[model samples]
Target: MKFNYLVFFALCGFLNLSAQEYYFPKANADWEQKSPKTFKIKDAPLQEAVAFAEANEYSGSRDLRIAIVKGFEREPFHQILGRTKKRGGPAGMIIKNGYIVAQWGDTKRVDMTFSVTKSFLSTMAGLAEDEGKIADTKDLVIDYIWDGTFDGAHNSKITWEHLLQQNSAWSGELWGGKDWADRPPSDGDIDDWKLAQPKEPGTVMEYNDVRVNVLAYSLTHVWRKPMPLVLKEKVMDKIGASTTWRWFGYDNAWTEIDGLQMKSVTGGGHSGAGMFISAEDMARFGLLFLNNGKWKNEQLISEKWIKKATTPSTPNANYGYMWWLNQKGDRHWEGLSENIYYAAGFGGNFIVIDKEHDLVVVTRWLEPSKVGEFMTKVNAAF
Candidate 1:
């Protein structure tokens, strides 16, 4: 009887592991869809959330080129420097246990996902750390690039962690985009920002595109290949994303690495180019994160990296490594789990992961302010 009990316990352990397994979609196969009733989710609240998202479509022009210009008119000399696309209408998907429980609009339509690209950029850093290409996030940037980009005393103090957390305070210009000029303080003029002393590294969180591009450029040098190719080979292709997705950089964002010229992709669509991808692909990426960087049997990104990437940074409790945290900060979403984290972009594109419910919510082109309420409704459904 004692031997029988031991065998029963071992079988139970195997069953528990199997229960936690996620369903991974095939590369070209149809994504399996599950009904909301399967999870005992309330139809009214679920439909309400979907309605809110659909009704609150982003106010930006379909011609994103005009919207881009109007959005950042305060910035000096900001223009469409790279590629921009006419955006599609409201689109989204809600994945429960790696299966689509609800989706709206065209999940297959490709659209620009502005700073959501930052999350992807940070993923490259995570990948580099996993492959030992980056020795440590705490290591200084000069140790890798050795370029004049990190030359100044302020920039010299910058580290990989600083950049990842957006607290680098690295003053510089890259691809003709000035750090200060990218998003200057509204209180003061151009000269004030130009001469303003940079904050100490790892002390202040400032959202600047040039600094983000610096990260992309530095990662390019470290990987010894274009970041887009690296992401495709290591991540997207493995996750079965469609070929329609494209990562773009400024026309001037090219660099010669090992006798080969490659474009250093932007971290956002601020000046036009970043990630142009489908909502379906975005959901897949979110599913990977929701599963803690694992895809079926393959651990594509280390679990350690995903944890670090999602953890709140010291300078900004509401921000992680290029990802947004739902902690009680300025950007906290009320009536939702504080543990939630998401990738947000300029025009209300979001890939929210609620681990507590095993939910991956991908919404694009919804009005930014309505997200909290929409999420509140989603949370109520379960």
Candidate 2:
């Protein structure tokens, strides 16, 4: 018995020693900055990368007000943060081996990150599974959520795995928006969308905010608290993130939980009100994953959960649990690892993780088409 305990302690000791290798950045925007030369990264390509990024920043609407009306061909969702707080500009940083190799723009500005918020929502689901709030991803979601949201026959077949992989095809109206109305085809009308038949759950992958919201709502129910609070206490605070970051949902998203009313946050800012955070804060979140969910001797989220989170869904090889993966090597330059995955949002916001290079990259307002070129340049530097 003593020897058995000794083995357990020995393994724990090894894990603790390995955890110290990750460098968690400082808060208050005091994160250390290092030059490419310091890391033996080439000077020319690094400069070219920065210049390329600066010259080809996202030209889309920096304001959600204009972006929604002009880009989506729809109005804002029922509830959202006021339009005044939205600030859009080019900002980013590149971290190699857990240190900042290069950065540009206003990394401190809080802006709308749109669908990048989905990745954070994915993290919340990981937490739920870790805490046993969700026993199995394959278990039907209707089993846990007693509400009528999953009452229909089509919806009843949906499971947490289906939802996380964007293959649930969950049918229901949420916050005055129908599931199909979120992103109909170019020529498809709302009337046509409403009558559209949903594919069998787990058979098709579709990016729908309504279904994403269902995941958020279900998670909020299981947690019995606001998601922002859960994120802060469980993740942001643990990673030494700044206090300024916020997670929000629509205005009418409030519900009674544990005898108290709380707002159910959205996974992305498609309509509005997702995550408003700085680039540094986003990097810390990426670093946590680059280290396989270990944060300084503490396994805040289980490594098993992270593996599932990053693995490509069977139905969608390029997407994993709300995270976009570069499985085909199409989005990145050649010679880079296929293990590269990222959280991408509208306005070209990206949190790219390259495990092979031990790198984390955060970029805001970069031109969508130039991402590969920028990455190619970054790779050249190293």
- lDDT of all predictions, in order shown? 0.92, 0.83
Highest lDDT scorer: 1
Model 1 spans with C-alpha error above 4 angstroms: 2-19
Give per-model TM-scores. 0.96, 0.91
Q: lDDT at 342 for candidate 1?
A: 96
Give the per-residue lDDT of model 1 (tens digit) for 103-133. 9999999999999999999999999999999
Q: Please, what are the lDDT tens digits per residue for candidate 2 over residues 181-256?
A: 6777766566766687999998888889889999999999989989999999999998998888888888788778
TM-score of model number 2: 0.91
Candidate 1, run of 10 with poorest lDDT: 13-22
